[model samples]
Target chain A: DQQVKQNSPSLSVQEGRISILNCDYTNSMFDYFLWYKKYPAEGPTFLISISSIKDKNEDGRFTVFLNKSAKHLSLHIVPSQPGDSAVYFCAASNRANAGKSTFGDGTTLTVKP
Target chain B: DVKVTQSSRYLVKRTGEKVFLECVQDMDHENMFWYRQDPGLGLRLIYFSYDVKMKEKGDIPEGYSVSREKKERFSLILESASTNQTSMYLCASSSLGRVWGETQYFGPGTRLLVL
Candidate 1:
């Protein structure tokens, strides 16, 4: 059973526009959510994260919104650039789990230049 | 910068052959993990070790085994390689900071193709 799920396999957006990637989870025990961006032939890097206590977290052009009631979270990149085109994976974990995160299938975002 | 290095970027093996994938981390991290990334299946944890001579099975640990004789190195071994085992393998490490849920730093990945 996949605890974390990304319904959309891919997304396309124009440069300078906003790119939104959505993710859902079935486990309510997860209190921490993180996003990772991966490029071809490279490893994934941390993007943004949000805690269950907060509804939103923002850093630069990246913003992550979490809704505990819905067990859903979304990553938003405003003014998306070509460099933002990559696979985004959503992961969830709880403090007691020793950082063993349950990752989603990942969404491939394409930013049109 | 933390650096996680895998033995090979790519490898090919035949059925029934034994395969070993090695990973080394420069940062003195206490936590090391082995994950497999398939097309539709994001990243699945195969094994993880929190310290030298310690190990734990992740979600999918079948058909594979791991060793961490040293704190800096972790190895994933396939006793009898199968075609179904062909996939991208990733290694990650994180320091058990003052907190336990530290972020993980990943390697470039090793793409293994089992024939």
Candidate 2:
């Protein structure tokens, strides 16, 4: 069973516009969530993360919002740039399963300049 | 910064051949994992090691085995190369902490093709 799911396979946006990526999970035990960005032929790099206790986390131009009641989380990029184009993966893990994370299928984001 | 390194960036092997993919971490992490990425399937864990000489099977460990000989190195072994086993393999390591979920550092990944 796929615990974490990214329903959208791909997304296209114009530069300077807002880009939003969504993810949902079925496992309620998951207390921590993470986001990773990957480029072609490269491994995924950590983007931002949120705890179950928090509703939002922001870093620079990126923001992550978590709604525990809905079991959904989203990543938002303000003023999206072409360089931000990449595949984004959403992962969930809890303290009991530290180090082992359940990852979504990933959503490919393309930003047009 | 944590650094994870894999032995190969790409590999090709014929059916029935034995293969080994090596990984090393510089941060002395206690937890290490091996995962395979496939199209539309996301990343599936093959094995995980929490300490030297210790390992646990992951979601898809049917054709794979793992070795953790030291604190810094974790290896993935393919007993018999098969076409279905070809995929991008990733290695990651994370330190233990009081926090709920520690961030994992990943290697560049090794793409293996079996014929």
Candidate 3:
């Protein structure tokens, strides 16, 4: 059973437009959510995170929003650049349990010029 | 900066052969993890170690074993390699945290192919 799911396998957006990636989770115990960006042949880099206590968290050009009632979260990147093209993964964790994190299947985002 | 290194970036092995994948971390972290990445499956945990000589199975641990003799190093062993085991392996290390969540630092990854 996949605890976390990214319904869309791929997403495409024009440069300078907003790119939105969505994720859902079935585990209610998860309290912390994070987003990671990965390039080809490179390790994933931490992007932004949101705690269950808050509905939203923002970093520079990236923003993450969480809806606990819906068991869903989304990552939004405004003014998307070509460099933003990569696979994005949504991860969730319940720190109380050994800090193990569950990750989604990842969404490949392509920012077109 | 935290650095996690894998023994090999790519490896090819024949089916039924024993394979060992080694990972080392320089950050003195207490938590270490092993994950396998597939094309559309994302990252799935195989094993994780909380301390020296301690380990716990993750989401997918079948046909895989792990050893953590030292706090800085973790090893994943495939007793008998199979074609289904071909995937990108990743190692990560992180420090335990109380409130401010722990951040996992990952290695580049090792691509393994079993023919």
Best by DockQ: 2
Specify the poorest-scoring 10-residue window by lDDT in model 2 chain A. Answer: A94-103
Candidate 2 chain A vs. true chain A: TM-score?
Answer: 0.98
Pairs in clash, predicted candidate 3? none
- Tens digits of per-residue lDDT for model 1 on B1-115? 9999999999999999999999999999988999999998899999999899999999999999999999999999999999999999999987776342467889999999999
Name the runs in model 2 displaced over 4 angstroms: none
**Candidate 2's residue-wise lDDT over A31-79, tens digit each?**
9999999998888899999999999999999999999999999999998
* lDDT score, candidate 1, position A67: 91
True contacts kept of 3: 0.50
Taking the tens digit of each residue's C-alpha lDDT, what string does model 1 give over A1-113?
A: 88999999999999999999999999999988999999988888888888888999999999999999999999999989999999999999877776678889999999999
The lDDT values for all models are: 0.92, 0.93, 0.94
Ten residues in sequence with the least summed lDDT for candidate 1 chain A? A93-102
**Alpha carbon lDDT at A52, candidate 3:** 90
All-Cα superposition RMSD per candidate: 1.1, 0.8, 0.9
- Which segments of model 1 are wrong by more than 4 Å? B98-100
